[model samples]
Target: MFRKWESPEAVFHLLKACSKGMPCDITGIDDYRMIDEKRGIQWPLPDGHPIEPLSERRLFEDGQFYTPDQRARFVFEAPRPLPEPTTSAYPLTLLTGRGTSSQWHTQTRTGKSYVLRKLHPNVPYVEVSPKDAAELGIRANEWVIVRSQRGQVKARVFVSHVVQPGQVFMPMHDAATNQLTFAAFDPYSRQPSYKACAVRIEPAPVGRSNHSALPALNLFIASLGE
Candidate 1:
């Protein structure tokens, strides 16, 4: 079944003639040919479109919407509390976001290039405010264990004023980063609340003279497999 529709042409044909019907206005092979001719084409470019020689275009120029009233509607709701709140054990809020513009999500594809890797930090590290680091006795570039209710992961501390005293920032590129995030989600969108979680940081235990952070990380991952 998989081999039957492997090629791009076959997939395109199937999309054009699906029983459920195509969501967009992709009619036939000519539409694809038009896409190749023009670098890219916007969606809803049905066959015999009014705008000839389709180039770049925008939708709803006249402020019209796909509604019975032809006007957009806005909805508002009261804010809800975070699923995991900070406690005495886990006092700091862990905020996760993109590390660098050069690195994509998870680093599955963008991590391949040596040049790209050089542009960003090679290893996972958490951003800690100077005030917070000073209180915790954590120095810059020192190994630290970030712990949440879900799990814990070792990361290097980067002392910066960018984060607030009660908040720490970690990039989502690291695999272990998500291990500390709670499975709570928004009720409406159903998107997991990856931004905020309760966490605490402590200095990592000293290792042998020959052991390094990389080897420690490998051991941590191996332990998870068990």
Candidate 2:
């Protein structure tokens, strides 16, 4: 389907048309010059040289690839399971991806805009397998606390058949979710395992901690009253 756009101009025109829903001049050199001026100011300046053209397209032009031979190299990597697991307490393995709507990542900047915030709030949510839901005694749209090795946060529960028996999914837009996630990094990419992680979802606790600190606070308040 995309073979018709072998030319960069055609691809640019297609993107413009898709975004604006109107046909635009794809053959015009002015568009390229405008892009160069506004963004690069060095490329295609009527001098035939793009600001950062692919000056070096091919290497080792001896009609062959590889080092001293045309043999292909193979790369092997061992597979490792995700860090988190579905266990007795964390019976559902939660995976997080992107949200479906218009908000950006974590809704950090987009969340500030009133319009975008109304469309999507900074709320963490968990996807649950039907089997897990039955076992956990929870339902969709209900609040639950997801706890990990790092911390805990409240999120609404969502059920889907797409989720497997031991796996759950979430969108990584809410800070609350981040608080509950580990900050471990991948060996190759140095990226966090945002998708698959161990999580336990239960009914959120209702009361505050009854630690003796509360009595200290109360005593202080009482002394002030005197």
Candidate 3:
């Protein structure tokens, strides 16, 4: 599986090149230490000497990519039809993913250590558009229930322009949010579009006692009047 932090493009390109009978050059060092030292090496370096431990060189520097037409092929694009497209029933779309930090699919394990959780406690909150918040009577940092075709979960709403009119974003770090997200996978890549799935959000039900705010004296006076 590709890592959220690592780029899969290099591996994909190298594999494709090998399939086409393009010979790859290796200088005969195959030890773990060599691999670690060559981690920053670049391909096609003259005399096999990489300019940097990590190659910062961009491909196609010579404006050629081994194609006769010198143009990259737009072979195919898997149709994504936009997850939860219409949302006529749901009325919103939810996209969830990760940030540069955070280490896993859920925070249950990460939250155990005080220092780690404190480093990013409930960070990357759910984002909703200002218009949606206004309609639902929710303020930033207030709670909202995000319901997808799969299920629902409560998250703190963070109203901002970055969130589109009908789209909301939540980081996948929280299992609680995942419970309400689509688990569909891309047929070809086997990658799930954890982003851009259909969903709906509303102000969660507030559970507070209506009479709990009254003073004891007020209750007694009301009882006497009754």
Tell me each candidate's RMSD, in Å, in order: 6.7, 15.7, 12.4
For candidate 2, report its TM-score: 0.58
Q: How far is candidate 2 from the true structure (C-alpha RMSD, Å)?
A: 15.7
Q: lDDT of model 3 at residue 104?
A: 59
| Clashing pairs in model 1, backbone N/Cα/C closer than 3 A | none
lDDT over C-alpha atoms for residue 45 of model 1: 53
Q: Write the per-residue lDDT of candidate 1 for residues 80-136, one digit (tens) a residue.
A: 777889999999999999867878887898888887765654567788999999999
TM per candidate comes to: 0.76, 0.58, 0.55
Off by over 4 Å in 1: 5-32, 46-51, 54-73, 208-226
Candidate 2 C-alpha lDDT tens digits along 1-226: 4986988866766654454411221223345557666563422123233434534423334454444476545557698776766577766676777754657778767778887655554455677779988888987666678887778877666777777977777777776666766667887658787776677777875544322243333332233224
Model 1, position 34: C-alpha lDDT score? 61
- TM match of model 3 to true structure: 0.55
lDDT of 3 by residue, 1-226 (tens): 3353255545544443444423233333333355567663444433334455433766677666657797655558865487558457788777777732634567767768676554455533577788988887888655567777778786666666777887778878876666776677876568876677777777777655322323432332233224
Q: Assess the local accuracy of residue 147 in candidate 2 as a C-alpha lDDT between 0 and 100.
A: 81
How many pairs of residues collide in model 2? 4
Rank the candidate models, highest lDDT first.
1, 2, 3
* Count of clashes, each model: 0, 4, 2
